[model samples]
Target: MRVMVLVKATEDSEKGFFRDPATIEMMEAMGRFNDELRDAGILLTGDGLKPSSEGKRIAFDGAGRTVIDGPFAATRELVAGFWLWDVKDVDEAVAWVKRCPNPMPGPSEIEIRPLYEAGDLQ
Candidate 1:
């Protein structure tokens, strides 16, 4: 199965905390973790995102589409980064997440969700 592992954004992440000198160790740790995933042939693609302030949102309703600027209000609701991984099952993905370094300066969350294959629609 394929899974998208989302690294949920925190206030510190939204403010670019990972770029801080104090978090260098954490960044290094995360790099090592990614290398492990790649070495295992589990990693498909992954990268961290810039702050929401540099992003934009598009809202649609019926025939109308609205473009919203970012730095969105919700902190915990945002995604700071993500990994596209091909794993044997959700449990395997969960196991990988358990080994990930903390992506934030403080408490953070990583959500793993399975992607639906086209055959599911049959």
Candidate 2:
């Protein structure tokens, strides 16, 4: 099974906060976690994203179009980063996600979802 692990963004992330000692420690921990996943043959790909402020959003309504700037607040619910992994099943994906350390200082949340396989549509 394949899964996508979503990392939600926060205000500090959008503003490009400095990477303090704590942040570095957290990143090191995450690196170790990724190593574990790779050693277990689960990790396919993973990466962190640039701040939302560097991104752009476009919306189209019929003949009308609108462009929204970044540093978007709704980003709190948007994906700031992601991880793709191959696992045994949904249960295994969930277990792996549970082992991930929180990225943000506050209540960071990670959403895990299964990817659609070739026969899933059927």
Candidate 3:
């Protein structure tokens, strides 16, 4: 099964602050973790995202469309990064998440969700 691990963004991330020394260390640890995941054949791809302020969103309603600018209002509800994993199951994905280093400073979180496969529609 395929899984996507979502790293939730914080206000600092939304503002695109520079990484502190501790954060840089955390990144290096995360790189090691990624190496392990790759050697284990679970990680397909993963990377951190830039601040939402650098991005844009488009919404559709009926036949009308709207383009929304970024630096989005909901700072706490944005995504900071993600991992695409080909895992045995959700359980395995959970295990991997448990092993991941803190992706942010202070309190942070990563959410794991299963992806829908084309076979599911059959």
Candidate 4:
């Protein structure tokens, strides 16, 4: 099975909390965790994202499409980063997430969802 792990953005993340001096420890911890995932052959890809101000949104309605600039509202709903992993099942993904270090300085959340495999449609 494959899964996408979503790292939800927090207010601090939107403000580039990773740039803060105090976050060095957190970064190191995350690096170690990432290494663990890679060593276990579960991690396919992962990376953190820049703030929403640097992004754009494409909204579609009927045959029309509108391009909206970012610095979007709803901080908690935005994704700060993601990981694509090949695992045995959602339970395995959950177990890995449970072992992860907090991605935010104050509060944070990581969501795990299974990817639709080709066999799923059959």
Best by lDDT: 4
Better of 3 and 4 by lDDT: 4
TM-score of 1: 0.94
Which residue pairs collide in model 2, if any?
Answer: none
- Write candidate 1's Cα lDDT for 20-87 as tens digits: 67589888999999999999999999999989998999999999999999899988999999999999
- Write the residue-wise lDDT of candidate 2 on 18-119 in tens digits: 778988888899999999999999999999888987888889999988899776778678777899999888889888888888777778888888889999
lDDT of 1: 0.92
Global lDDT of each model? 0.92, 0.85, 0.88, 0.93
Tens-digit lDDT track for model 4 on 4-67? Answer: 9999999888887545677898888999999999999999999999999989999999999999
TM-score of 4: 0.95
Better of 2 and 4 by TM-score: 4
In model 4, which residue pairs have backbone atoms overlapping below 3 Å? none
The sequence of per-residue lDDT tens digits that candidate 3 reaches over residues 4-122 is 99999987667675768877898889899999999999999988899988899999999989998787877668899999999999999998899888888778889998999999889
- Comparing 1 with 2 on TM-score, the higher-scoring candidate is 1
lDDT at 19 for candidate 3? Answer: 67
Extract clashing residue pairs from model 3: none
